[model samples]
Target chain A: MTALTLHAPILLVALPLLGAFATPLVGKLGKGARNTLIGLIVLAVAGLAAMLAIDVFGSGGIPTVYELGGGTFTFPLSGGQVPVRILFEVDGMSAFMGLITALIALTGAFFSFSYWKERSGGNLYFSLFLMLIAGVFGMVLTGDMFNFFVFLEITSIAAASMVGFRVWLKQSQEAGFKVMAMYTLSGLFVLLAIGLLYGQYGHLNIAVLARSIQGSLTDMVALGLLLTGLAMKAGAVPMHMWAPDAYGESPAPMSAVLVVNSQASLYGLFRILFTLFGASISTGTVGWILIVLALLTIFVGVTMALIQSDLKRLVAFGAVSQIGYMLLGVGVGMAVIATRPEYGLVAMQGGIFHMINDAACVGLLFFASGVVIRAAGTRDLNQMGGLGHRMKWTSIFFAIGAVALAGVPPFNGFASKFLIYEAAFKLNPFLAVLAVLSSIMLLAVFVKAFQAAFLGPRSNTSAHVSDPSLGMMLPMAALVLVVIVFGLFPGFFVDHIVTPAAKALWLGRDAYINAVLGG
Target chain B: MNIGNLPFIVAALLVVLGLYTFLFKRNLIKLVIGITLIETGVNLFLVTLGYRTGGISPIYTFAPEAQQMVLPTPQALTLTSIVIGLATTALLLSFAVFVHRHYGTLDVRKVKELKG
Candidate 1:
């Protein structure tokens, strides 16, 4: 491998982190310059991440593990299973998540120039935005459990500030506070779990610790804590009370990245489940717990969305429910892996694939809602009507996002949800039925929203409404392309990306251990 | 089962109590205190786990009297957690101050604006 490819793993994280700190300095140049700089930084990171992903996906599915600050001289004395320095392990799953995160951050940054240009705290906004993005990359890329905890805290702090950015608004501040409490409390639980593992195993490296864990009572309790904490962070019910508000309160660009933030927690959940404990976990019982929670998250998330009149709040609830499909798919896979490995693999692929697909679909929806909120200068669906007459391009964008989010045919959501249904059907008929039903309800929910916001007589006060600037339209169009392309080529995506991602988690234990141990 | 485990049990209860207050308390200040409590408890748990009876500090001193040293990694971890805990508490308390300034109340229920 060339040095650039060899170094892409660390560059993927450090570049954004350095850019985060550099943003305030850059902001002094000009708002336009600052936005352009942040966008370029994200684009660079995305390019590096994509390169790393292509190399990994093309390298016979072998993961690229980079040890930070470790040359032969620095750690030549190290001979144990646990590597002492911080490490970035980019398997198919991590690479995939990183790629999507950079993509969302890129679009979010692209859309931010227009949204945040005249707004206050432009410097603080870009700095915090970059920090949030960097935190996600750190969270997804790290190999040490303690490093994960630190990055989790980093992300939550940035997220809390971003959520409450509009402190003049009572709801925004309150949402920030509520999310802070939940995220901090949840974060403590993660730290406690990390401590428990460290106290027992005397190592922080995940692969090393996983190899040594014996599934004792302490391990069981640690797993329980990790599951609850990460699940809560992922917005799984009944701990999902913070999600809708956090999403609803944040500005549009932040909300787009926030989608991926929650997905990072979900990625952590899956990583811990199938990688750290896959070799020794009692899959049936643990998987059952996840499944039950998944069911609750889905049903309640959709029902809640159906009742919401606030445009952003409605989309937020819908985002929560989409997380359930991912959980259910993977949870089902986990439940049956001990018996039917083949079906489990298929289900796992569907679940992992849905992460990226959900990022695209929900991301598009959130961005479009931001556009509508901008043109109309209000977020209430009741205050909106006949936007199509004024904002033709944005209405079309919303229509595309709406149908794709509802899992209609020729959209990305359908392909993954279809795989989820078919694979989950082989495991249990009711789960599949429930998946289909919730999807239908999702369709109904968005259809009602579209009708409320776009299809009626144009509001007399909304002579001001017009199509969004090129900033917003371009991102939505980009997502529309993603949805259409991925939808049409589901088989190819499954074969190339999703399967490797599933295997990285499903069959990662031994290879991960051997790599960390330098065997 | 032994005297050594007493601090561990107390630490666990302290965590539970902290979470209870953080989740159930009406006052925002109490919620902040709750996080501090959990941080203290977790730090105690880490320190306790790392302690070795009749052992000295793990510092790199050349004192002839030193024989055995306690495990230092958990101590380092706890210190890092404590620092992070301090930063979060500062940020959260600042957020609470802003909320109170804007809404004219410190009660969480009173500040509920963006409801689902």
Candidate 2:
């Protein structure tokens, strides 16, 4: 147990990476061997993530730091003034994000098992999938800025390839190109920011930089680049032009994984805001900036979703909107952080809790939609009627996902959004009103989709539609179960998991810095 | 203008030019070139960050004692960025090829099949 805990952080990232490369070689054996190998790798990753989360959360939010190249874990490296060796820092927040990634990756892998049965290049597909997962894990766990950029690029390349994996489809190619271009542009923005910071501080270690940051004009410039780049990746409005294309065009299971990838970038954004530049910047200005972006994202995402005739695109827009809720929640928290307002902690908890809830809700929706698209042979909602007649299990799963995502009561979405709304109301009633209106609009949008695709008279196109095999159904069912369980026990989860994760960001900065640099 | 800051000025100009080409040019291949240009600018900036006017290479094995050495980290960072840039550019160009094959044109304006 000690050994596993000691190595779990690195193992969480390295195992999937190694498995990705080993997949093609294992593919030479047989499909059964390949599937089993991928399944085992995902399961092992989930187990490690779970163990690490338990360790971090149980330790009362002290981060677990692992040094590479077998040196002492403390910073200032024996005789050096600045820490140069690479390290992995797993705090409550990182562990929380890891658990979310593991859950979605596990389900996405399982769902892809049957989804990819008829598809060629299954080996390559799983390989890229594993690479994407590894990249996300690394992004959330790495303690260095350059390492984060490298992981960001890895996710970008793997994800873009997967988006265009259907080389035969013209739309897929177009989406792939646009997404890759945007991802590359954003990544360069990040690299340039890292360069600026390194030129000033002569160190790439995040904790060291955070300790040394003085918020000069150069620092603010770097901040602007980091913010714009990560927000673009996270699908914030005005910079979110590529999201619908990437999400709507990719394979269904890949869409769910892509949502998690965006959230990983979102994680990076928060890390920068709270931990790295926490004390240096004017929190109120930056917090209000996030709030404004959140409002725009929510309004635009829902309204656009309402008009989308393509079922996946509608869900994709909905996914983008959910990013707004998280931003609003965390933005409220950040706005009030300096004052230490009572509601600030609550708001942070809401935002952090919403992340896992959104993952499950969105993942279920995408998986269910994948099944629908597969059965009906079309993505057009108008052309996909009466699927509920035959696809009984999928209909139930889709309904659960839709209701949960729309923030309906007694589902996970409402539980988290309730916290956000209450806190936002306390902060400013106007913000709460806008959030509620958007939630209502989101509900209406999903309702229209549900009616158009599943609740109508049988069309000729859906005559052959039926429930997918247990393989795919199980993953969706698992997510449905998560939605219900999280909804029913929101307080339990908030106290145990979400609070620690939130506090790690809201109030754990000193511990984080000290863990690396020592007191 | 200060001579020492010239590299910085050139890097910023390169980035601006790349953005101009990326935003203004219609050809998909040209867009790829634009991206590469931006990448080159960033790489140059990273390399320049570590340069010291009279410092020797960072290799300590054969160096004269008690002399200044340019920072090795930024150079290392530049090399990694270049490799990553190559991969990104290769991927972008391949996607362009596929797009041209399917759409029969490389014009960005022509690839409107995905928009609302």
Candidate 3:
């Protein structure tokens, strides 16, 4: 027991991974038994994560670094440096992500209990869900670049497959194809960049590579490739075309999982920009390039969302726009680092804070859309009217989600966006003005969503549209409550959690190496 | 152990050719071929990074008194990378089969049901 508890972090990953393999065998026990077994395991994992988060952050903050393979340092390079072989560093940021991931997975698994169809390959769904959890957890925990890429592949492949789980539908298959193509291609670019870094410095660990490699042309090339690859995964504009189709095609529970997954990519983007490259490398054209991308991403994402008629696609596109907001915050931080590095801290804090808020709010929005879709049997706005009359709980939840998404005060979105707006304005007034424009547009758009789906007169088949099962409504209700609670009390999330994270990011090179490789 | 040898140049040329195939190939299989070529190029680069003048393999059993040992880390990483490439190639090919089954076509432009 003592030995098992000592390796708790590793067990967090190995548990789901082993569950993914063991699920098939467990499924053979009996019908409907697989999901129950997987749920029990994941619930335990979630509980473990919550406990770990509490332990890590109970005092100020705890940074636990583990050296893999017997904890003995093994030098794998000619440079005589201790090569990091499968290192897992658990800090506040990872602990936070771990908590959210486990919570969402637990809620999602609980929700999926009644959601999966007997004929819908339920066993496979459970298997993939476990694998997805493993991948996300690994992504947050792993310190080595190669392992990060491997986890990225795992998450992407599982997601693409799940996106097209309904293979009979041509659109699902097409969405799957497009997603697979983009994700794999982006992964190839990331691999090339990793190779570049490895060639320059004979190391694959992010911490060691950052220390050994400096701001050379090779570093720039590597950064560009890595940024482009990660941007594609983050669904930044131009590379974002695959997202709506993929999200729209996936099951609602799966879509909720995907919302967290996309946010996970944003986490990766943040880690790479602030954590991997540090402040010095983050300045100059790199910062400006991200700024341009963020500006366009917000403008393009919101505008595109405004024009969408399909409910799910509209929410998916709204996600793209929201990603713009986070990117904007990060870009502003990058731009500020060289001049007034203090402002960079605020910008990064706001950006990282928004990442958490956006995940919760947008995740709820997608979950609500899923409920509406399942109830209405159609995703088109023209067909969904007067649902508020019958599906009272859903209507209330959807409204809460929409309000939060639009950055309304006293809601979670408003708190994060407030900080983001302040940071952007402090850096560049022009950026603040543009962000305000996008926020106003976001408000108008979600208002349209509320009006069209809830407030309007009953369409022809509106009477038939009923609320989803209690299982589905419950998870979304919890998320909505969280949104409200976080909004009302933003300090708990921002000050204790996000501020330290952003400050850790702001320490520039020292923090970067310390976070990944430890002091 | 010449600084600029023909094998190195040939390896570089092979990589370029592979990239060209990736960019210009219309068939899905050929694109996979291009990716494989790119992986080979990367692996070659790793091996080349380890290459030292007159240095032999890092195997201690064959050359116990060897003063120069070619970097063994890159060789191990390249081996892992080669395995990853194999897995990717296999997954890509299997996806191609599925694509063929559904679309009945492999022409990149023809798979256009997902266009805007």
Highest-scoring model, TM-score? 2
State the lDDT of candidate 3 residue by residue for B60-106, as single tens digits.
88586847888887677678767767655666676666667788887
Give a tens-digit lDDT track for model 1, residues A1-519: 677887887787778888888888988887767777888898898888888888888986666778888765322124663577777777888888987897798878877777776789888888888888888998888888988998898899999889987778777877888898889888888888988998898888888887788898998899999999999999999999999989998987788788899999999989898878776789998888888999899999999999999999999999999899899989988998888888888888888888899888888888888888877778888888888788888777777777877789888888888888988899889888888898899999999888888888767856778887787778888888888899899899889888888888887666666666655
DockQ, Cα level, model 1: 0.70
Interface RMSDs of the predictions, in order, are 1.2, 0.5, 2.5
Error of 2 at A286 (Å): 0.1
Mind giving the per-residue lDDT tens digits that candidate 1 earns over B29-99?
99899989998999899888888877778987784474878888888889988888987898888889888
Q: Candidate 3 has what TM-score? A: 0.91
Candidate 2 per-residue lDDT, tens place, B1-116, comes to 22598899899999999999999999999999999889999999999999888888999998998898989999999999999998999999999999999999999999989877
After superposing candidate 3 on the true structure, give the runs of residues whose Cα lies further than 4 Å from its correct spot. Answer: A1-6, A59-62, A73-81, A279-282, A508-519, B1-26, B51-63
lDDT of each: 0.85, 0.93, 0.76
Residues A203-289, candidate 2: write the lDDT tens digits: 999888988999999999999999999999999998887999999999999999999999999999999999999889999999999
| Number of colliding residue pairs in model 2 | 0
Q: Is candidate 1 or candidate 2 better by TM-score?
A: 2
lDDT of 3 at A452: 83
Looking at candidate 3 chain B, the ten consecutive residues that score lowest on lDDT are B4-13
Best by DockQ, which number? 2
Judge the docking of candidate 2 as incorrect, acceptable, medium or high.
high
